[model samples]
Target: MDTTSVWRATAPKAALPSLQGDIATDVVIVGGGITGVTLALNLAEQGIPAVLLEARDAGFGSTGNSTGNLYETVSRGIHRIIDRWDKDVAHAVTVARREAVDQIERRVQKYGIGCGFRRCALYRYATSEEGKERVEKEYQGSLDAGLRVRWEPSLPPPFHPPHGQVMVLDNQAQFHPQAYVRELARQAAGHGCLIFEDSMVLEVDTDQRVVRTVRGKVSAKHIVLATHSPKGLHLVQAGMVVNREYGLATRIEKDGFPAGIFWGSGVDRISARELGVDDETYLICVGEEHKTGQEDANINLDRLEAAAAAHFHVRDIAFRWSAQNYAAADSLPYIGKDATGCFIATGFETDGLTWGTVAASIITDEIIGRDNLFAPLVKPSRFSPVKGAKGLVEENVAVLKSFIKDYVTDRPGIPLSQLMPGKGDIVKVAGESLAAYMDPNGNLLLVSPVCTHMKCKVHWNSVEKSWDCPCHGSRFAPDGTVIEGPATEPLQRHFLQDVE
Candidate 1:
């Protein structure tokens, strides 16, 4: 029941002080995930003064919650990219991602980061008849994307053998993401980059290039909003689809676990991998993706656990967590300056591990006045409604629906006294709807159910104990504190006393 990720719980910690006073630097990177930390290290090593601000510790976001699989293919399948754009664009995406993975390998070797970095083969197999066809298509897509792929008769032991052929891609890699990002932060700090932890940016003044936290602020010429989906409402958020995926890891075992990235197909879509890091081993399985804030978290998580148990003969589930991803309307991540003029990296979907590195490389080049070949492809300014019409329309409709439900519908709310212990709900208080949560100690915490990012209604995420925005994926704590997503302001708080 400990929802902490296995990577985060097992990885060693690197404690860094929070930002104290006002400071100015050449470049300021927000959010200390892989992208921000990599950019900080790359910039500082080149004699550029940079600083990184993290709301929590490094890699505490989706980066650490990731499956830790590194490959050139996107999780949604590269074939869709080719169909949306062209074969050339898909090839470019794969090439850029491969280079980023190589760069990660180089860093692991150069810095001796003990993150269980290893080269392994990735296998894509199917279980049902429909899934068999999907594997065939994915195999063709991999080849079209200029990857070295082959077909195997069936999957090996420790796996439910495929219903048909298995597509194998060699040279794919995996690593301990939490450990790698933490090590990258340490190295960046050693290279003169001021890395701050637990310093959440409360305000971003784009006009003055200043970002202010609770107790400190940083002004920089170049601002990189490496936070997932970017902070505050951006034009890109209007064109992206946000989703959450579940991940679970089994108890440490000595052997009998598979040693590759295995992705199953169809309604039984599950991505599985084994890890041997820091003298520990775990079999990790991740899948079950749904639109954020729109689905029952407990049901989705339980379904994933059921599938994991059905497929793999693994140990007891030890750790369980989830990750949020944003897919762009045009099948590509927006990785550069937008209309607001700040560098933003988002919409990487579930393939952010490789895309995050590619984004860091591209953004670093742009700030240093160097040309990166892949920069123009994913620049945030590009508008391709013809290619992105599907996602754009869905995003707009979702926003409108949230607004209407929050403003138009007659919402049935429970009275404060009817709110049960260890539960949260929208309660009617003096004719106003407010988010109310009752603690185990019989204490009540109340806050507005409105998300500050875009005035969208917030829904309770039962699994994570937070309020999630169905509009833009912003999440807040039960106390109205901002957790993540594009919301920079916390929810409005309401207090009541002696009112059952």
Candidate 2:
């Protein structure tokens, strides 16, 4: 089971050059995913000179690995939005999401991105009576939010029908996100935006508006922290909770699969969508979400595979991948100037593909000195004591527990020779906890188990072959390179002899 996403595996490679020497621009964007690339394109279209820096290729992060469902509705659902805020706010959020989807459609057609963009309906169904009641609430909420929704007693086939009830939202979409983003990057570059790939940003000096990479420096009037959860910002990081979800693409007979985005209601929610790759169609199923670093990826993958097999006719599993998303305490993404005067965007949860584009639209407006109506809804500095207080306390308590437990517990007192090939463990060596992974060739790779973000212990992710921090969701490769962040530094590598 390859952990690489089907989007990344199928899309053409990005050819942007890496940053070199010192460069200056009007704005410096850190990250190359959908948010960063979309922001770059937005600014470039307005004749702004922006430099987009990516540690890897465009769309290589969560955007490429996303299930690629573009929705006007969110995972928390419309009813929850109404409960959390008000009917007006919920309606406004729905409008903004619809605008974001329209913007993506416009761009794809205008630029001819060839990203397999298609408009489809979205169906959310229930399996139990309680689930059906929840779906009914969502249907009413959708109507209250000014969205056209239909309540059906049964859903179309390929989906197990005769359950409880279903709520349908029309005009939703899906696409090859990598292709869309890479094309946006290419267009941005053509419009005089400098796009750099494989250029890791080391530090950001918000006061001076400067970003430093290992080999180059970028002096800009503004900086956008589009690096998923906004690394290096303690205040913003504290207001969010991270969760990891698994996705699998399985081969489906052409025309045999149903054409719509399907979501099940309840704790164990399952989402499925039909996707066409080359001439073959693949049924993309995603679910099994858990707190980052709290559960085994293999178990989640098994659950996803089992769900797919039960619902539809599967030819073969084509791809397996996992993605992490941040959930803001207030249930709205933070997309405005932080306390340090730097622009930031994060906490999109399962709706990142749509909300990320919305963030881009807002941030781009801010950078261009234009007023955006939705800016206040997602302001980074805004705090809701009533709406967000409970979530804030619960999430931080979990983080605190992980930090304390990791430090107090002793690592396994096993010798390195006991590690099986392709296996990893946290072992005690020289009275210190070290992470050890043995490759197929019998070479032992060791690194400090302590997370660079907040000194929390990193657990081994067997499915992705990475070390994931439970506290802030920073992830590192087996050899200690940073993959995801709030932590800019890699895990400290140690030699076998040094650990012994």
Put down candidate 1 lDDT per residue, 1-500, tens digits, no spaces: 35799889988887999999999899999999999999999998899999899999999998989999999888888888888898899999999999999999999999999998999999988867779888888788888989899999988777877889899999999999999999999999999999999999999999999999998999999899999889987998999999999999885566767678899996689999888766677889999998888888999999999998888865488889999999999999999999888999999999998999999999999998999999999999999988999999988888788777778885578887788888888999887889988877888889999899988889888888889998889999999999997999999888985333
lDDT of 2 by residue, 261-345 (tens): 8888764478888888788788888888988988888988888787667666554887999999999887888998989888999
Whole-model lDDT per candidate: 0.90, 0.87
Q: Which residue pairs show backbone clashes in model 1?
A: none
- Residue 308 Cα positional deviation in candidate 2, in Å, after optimal superposition: 1.3
Give me the runs in candidate 1 sitting further than 4 Å from their true place: 498-500
Give the C-alpha lDDT of model 2. Answer: 0.87
What C-alpha lDDT, on a 0 to 100 scale, does residue 151 get in candidate 1? 90
TM-score of 1: 0.98
